[model samples]
Target: MADYRLHTIFYILTSLLSLAVLHWTVHKVLLSISRSKFKKANNCQPIPKYPNKDPIFGYDYWHALNKAAESRTLLSWLREQYRLYGNTYYARLQTANVISTCDPENLKAMHSTKFKDFAIDSRRKFAFLPLLGAHSVLLANGAAWEHKRAMLKPSFSRSQYTNLPLFERHVGHLIEAVRVENTKKGQVDLAEFFLCLTVDITSELMYGTSIELLTNGNKDLVRDMTQSAEGGHARWLLVFLANIIGNSTFSKSVSKVRNFMKRFVDEAISYRQHSESRSISAKPTARNFEGQQGTEPLDVKGRVIYLQQLSLGTRDRKAILDELTTILFAGRDTTAALLTNLFFVLAHRSDIYDKLRAEISVLDGERPTFEQLKGFNYLQSCLNEALRLYPVIPINTRMAVVDTTLPVGGGPKGQSPIFVSAGTNIAFHVTALHRRKDLWGEDAEDFLPERWEKIQGQGAWMYQPFGGGPRNCPGQHLSLAEAAYTVLRIVQEFSMITGRDSEPWTELIALTCTNANGAKVTLTEA
Candidate 1:
């Protein structure tokens, strides 16, 4: 009787399993048919697809991951896809159906004009939450984004321009560090030095404290941050999987970095509290911050440190930490990349360096004042050319919240606009867009600051190294000013900057474009 019951149970289980398999197969077939009919009814041409090695098992994604791993970048693969598929192409990754484009009209629509139709894709935000914080301005959308922007925008005002002296101090430290290297070995890994300089400057200016990373640098922390950024680029599905699997090494490292950042913020907050208490006790009438110039309005100088502004509004430490990390995220590498690239190109070209040095010579060996930095048109042009050639964030992404049509780059002929369904993600390669022969001329690849000489009348949309529209980077002016000041300082100290290697700058992606082998330069003392 027991044997007979066991046989019957086995048969029942097999029958149910077969039925489940049949149901799934039929559903897939019906869904495929429905999609085809829907496309036909719309009378729209499908977006071009880049052929992949495997279509069924997400082998294309795997292939991309492997290639990215081998090349230490995903940019080469993206450029290849663009070459094969023209202006726009469609590919299915593990996370979403990606529509990649280099069409300027399409870019304008996605980023500026129809920005409301798309978002940063909340699904992808999860990957960065552990690192950038949940309410980070970099990831927040809608009212949340606006609030974060409001909190930090005032801190960048003209009165805060008094921080130029602070920027100069760090630049001075950077020059000293490099000068020592020039005396001893005649070469410095400027990539590393630039990272340290930016870290110190960002900490001091924003938190009213300095980490001294440039003076006493942290190699391990820098390596970990770079690794975190690279991991930040991983597909969302993989991140989800890692989260579900639980206790991942990546998760641990992320936590470690978060803790490290939190500690930095806590210390800054502690210092601010102590400083304020001392100021109140010492001077009952007024508690003055040293950098606050008497002529500068309180609206600007009073809120120079972002943390102080936030503390006035809320006692939420997590929010403060989030904003602090956000500032560090924005301020550190982006400026460093700009400065490093500027020096990299300047090191290779003597004429440009000579002109820049002459520009600085007029300052009479003193630090260029805030207004003085703005007048260096050649310096401004060099910075612009470097940004155009190697945009720190080369690619930007958005996802449609509803079915939408791009203004251009579609159809079998590749000239018509494409209809992207809801949830479809779109990306624009700023690197490719900046280098468009049609937009920037045939010599777009050349690093010529003079190209910008007659182009003062151009629109802001044409060159968006700092991004665009309402969601555009708020720190653009500050970055330009800081970089221009640093270049002037460097020029004042070094007459000639020479590349350690004659071979061209080997570009690499580390959440930003940087020298792959490192930007090594020898300083010729002024």
Candidate 2:
């Protein structure tokens, strides 16, 4: 009886193993047939492959990328790769196949033409989940993303950002900080000051109260937030190991930052409830550019507080917190990086500075209104030029949710359609695209604001400092206005600006890119 039972068990185990092998074989055959059909139907051609020493895993290419990132030359390295391997090429990163492109046509197709065909990769979303909640607009896709976008749109309306008085108060703090730094050190790192200024402004706009980093209030918050962001970036780089090995320091810092934000969320909600119970409206006051105290009015309504606007949308505290944190992160870093990069160039080029000052001089020392700031032709040109040279988010990636074909980046000349398999990652290099000689002329490498004057427009997909399509930055006008207003004010106060650092601009990339050496400059007081 024991021998019979052993024989039966052995027979069953063998049958199960055979079935598993047959299932795998059938799936592989079906996948191969489907991919063949897809390639033929789309007329897809093979993309240029990188000349990797380890062709199987592309370890050579991966190692080179790490070295470039460590030396702060990743952008230049990427540009060189594009030059050598056409506008787009394919490489294997470990087990995954990666496509890198600096082609505008491919970018347009991914970001706009076939937007729904792609989604932010799961690795990116996983890395950011700690800093921004799972439901963050930055991480969500499909219907969830649409819902978050709709909820946040009203808060970034024209009336909300055009509150010049609110911005002036923050800019005043920045000017004072710069003056103090100049007196103490004989030179100011405007890059640092710009970060502080944006933090203060963003906090005030999002939470209805400033953390006041400019005045040295809540320095720990800034430090913690920085640590958290760095930790998130590290996790994004090592996504495979991130789940297995946890960093306690990263967790603590993220918690601190979230807790700090939650306090504001709770307060906003509580205040809304109290006001409703008492049948009263809450009004916030701000000092005008002239330093006069007054209640700043917007469309005959009181000041538009982002927190208040969000409270009306939904009472779910976590949902509101996620949206607020996501916007705050984007708004603060983007504007700061823009100011740092633009000012770094301005400090070196006195001619450009004088031209900008001459344009701003039309205000005759008066503060600029929203309409006036938008109308400054030369100022707009300088901003455009800076963005072209140093895009804040230098490189971005999207994953193919379903099998799709890119408009270009295949065949010998890279003008043929390429079949992108589902689960493939496509990284689009914005810095390389902006600096392409073919798109922007031979002097694309140079920082000449005059280029904007000569060109009718940058042409579609050619100049996307704020990105393009449905997922394009909503705070585009806000950041531009803030940078423009701050620049005009600084130029008005200082008679001349001179670069203190002899070193050329090197990238200090985090969530955004800024000058590695900092924007060190001496400002001669007017």
Which candidate ranks first by lDDT, i.e. highest?
A: 2
- TM-scores across all candidates? 0.82, 0.92
lDDT of 1 by residue, 1-526 (tens): 9999999999999999999999999998997787667656655576788675565555576567557746655665666667788878877665467788877778778778988888887555866777778767888887677666766766677655556878878888888888897889968878788888877877776776777877776776677676666566553336466566654555666677677777766664675576557642121211122212111112233545666655443446777777788787688888889988887887788899999988778888987777788888889899989898888888778889876678666677777667788898787788777887778898988998988887874336667787777888877877888888888888888888888877666566645676676678888888
lDDT at position 188, candidate 1? 86
Let me know the TM-score candidate 1 reaches against the reference structure: 0.82
The global C-alpha lDDT for each of the candidates, from Candidate 1 onward, is: 0.73, 0.83
Off by over 4 Å in 2: 53-58, 242-249, 275-304
Per-residue lDDT for 102 in model 2? 89
Q: How many residue pairs clash in each candidate?
A: 0, 0
Cα error of candidate 2 at position 375, Å:
1.4
Question: With candidate 2 superimposed using the best TM-score fit, by how many Å does residue 75's alpha carbon deviate from the native?
Answer: 0.9
